[model samples]
Target: MTRILAAALSSALLLASASAETLKDTLPHISVTGEASEEALPDRAILHLDIVADRLTATEAVTENERKTRSLSDGLVRQGVPIDDIRVVGVTLQSVATEEAAPRGAHGKHVSRGFRARSELSVTVNSLDEAASLLSRAIDAGSNDLRGVEFVVSDERTRLERLRIAAVKDAEQRARNYVEAVGAKLGRIIEIDHQEAVSATEANGRTEPLASASGVAFLRLRPGVRRLTARVSATWALSR
Candidate 1:
């Protein structure tokens, strides 16, 4: 009975697909796909780093790492970052074994080398002005590894929505242009399929860039022009 039910569901899906394909192929329409992305300056930066301490014992390593983490957080606050924005994301204590650090046994086995304690930190900086200083302070305070600094637009959802709107408009315009070039008129839209659409709605709000206060250039890092793509395939009827 289970096998029979599965086969029936599969057959229904196949028939539905075939019906849709028949309409797509038989309809007198012009189909076009459009792609677009959003671009704007970054409004926020996230700094990721690890505060690591290596010692002969796990307790020593953990103690040192905790001290360094405190220092790191304090330094970031001093650099104008909000205390709440700094986060200790993860902690790890592990014993590492190295051929050179550990002694070789009779059967070529290795002994305990060292214990490393690491703390991961994620800091969100609202203003880019404090990013460099905060990063430098983290290193000075005992941050061992600099993972990466992510530049981001806080209105990411809205930006993606705009990209989808743009792509839809692009497809519509393309269909119109094609019909016009062929001496025909574009009629009603038959199908609108977003192939690789991001889950976003149309947004009307837009941000205006602030003008520079001075002619002298200050090194400001912004998330450069980014392409967020939304692909749309649209079919429209053509009238002669």
Candidate 2:
């Protein structure tokens, strides 16, 4: 009985392998790579602000940082911005020397004069028209450190779907062109592999710094357009 079962399993494996080989031999397919891209004006802006302060004690430094952050958030809200859009991204505390440390001693030890605390704020502006005004308000409220703004598209998923359709059409067109050139006719599609879409933001311009009489400084930014790309690879059967 054992020998019979072993023989039956071996026969089944052989038959399966033979079937796979036959299928491969009968179906000849051609593979092609296709790509499509679309561009849309950025409808959103992400700005990073840092509230940094240094004090003799860590607690004092952190307190000052928090106070400034609160002011900034309140200012953003007053500007008709949504409360959910303003968030604290990160907080950091570091010991920093007020002046350059003296030359290394025999013990190889350095002294820090005070602790610097930094609170990072992230604000997403949905309305590009209000970006400049909001930025100025945040700075005036108490945001001491300013980082550049990033422009992005809000309706990215819709654009991506459109690109997918374009990509499939592009593949079909190319396949047809190839088959015609080779004196063959394109048959039904046997396989399709959709590649992940690649997207990038093209910052058309930078923000110019604005200084006010109250020692508030911020950048006036322009939300530029971004480009999105989709790629696909397809395999179709060929015939004479």
Candidate 3:
């Protein structure tokens, strides 16, 4: 019995050692990150415009805002903008004080009995050439609240797919370099993680109306190349 127990313990120890060696040989304890980027031009633009009306009564404010919003939508459609692209974001009614909450120097304070209402619209413009002009026309047609414009790529999936391939290659190259430096052969990849990033450049401040609203003016929509960056982390097995 004593001899059998000693043999069993020895066998267990040898098995554990072999397992550890196998794990050390196959598993990659080294992790490496690689990044790849591609430049692309944006094909779509999102225009956020708001039509606001402030009146003594909430009903009056809402009525006025609806009328103006309708006019703006019609004008945009007349200017060749697609009807389906227009979306109403929100409509709000809020009370305002006609009289100063605190008394000003001389004038007797008058209190407001009504509310103000505002309507917001978001339009997605597919054509870059028509974006600024359409916005200007919308402004002319009673769109007072021009929030801003955002440019984006319509076919982002294709770009990201290409970037993913490049990123994986880059990760593999980095892993190879690391293993070579450490004097080890790279084995199969054990794990991989991938992520994609999108970035854009835009003109923010208030823009003056172009001299020609209908004609194609030199709209310097210098959309900087949107960089689709992909980062991949790979764990490569190290072989002796």
Give the number of the best model, judged by lDDT.
2
Q: Which stretches of candidate 3 lie over 4 Å from their true place?
A: 1-26, 98-110, 201-208, 213-220
TM-score of each: 0.65, 0.76, 0.76
**Model 3 lDDT per residue over 197-230, tens place:** 9875443422444566657443334355677888
Off by over 4 Å in 1: 1-26, 37-39, 101-109, 182-187, 193-230, 237-240
- Give the clashing pairs for model 1: 37-228
Query: Which stretch of 10 consecutive residues in model 1 shows the poorest summed lDDT?
Result: 198-207
Candidate 3's displacement at residue 92, Å, is 1.6
Error of 3 at 191 (Å): 2.0
In candidate 2, residue 25 scores what lDDT?
68
Report clash pairs, candidate 2: none
lDDT of 1 by residue, 1-240 (tens): 999999999999788667656776876788899878654666677888999898999999999999999988887787678899999889999997764443555344466778999999999988776665566657767888977777766777777777778889999888888889989987777667774432323222222233246542233444444445778888787778
lDDT (0 to 1) per candidate? 0.74, 0.79, 0.77
Candidate order by TM-score, decreasing, is 2, 3, 1
Overall local distance difference test of candidate 2: 0.79
- Give the least accurate 10-residue stretch of model 3, judged by summed lDDT: 201-210
Model 1, C-alpha of 52: deviation from truth (Å): 0.5
Question: Distance (Å) between predicted and true CA of 79, model 3?
Answer: 2.5
Question: What are the per-residue Cα lDDT tens digits for candidate 2 across 1-240?
Answer: 999999999999788667645654689767888889877777788888888989999999999888888887888888877899898989999998645445666343466789999988899998766787787777767888777787778888888888888898999899999889989888877656676554445445567777767776756676555678888887778899
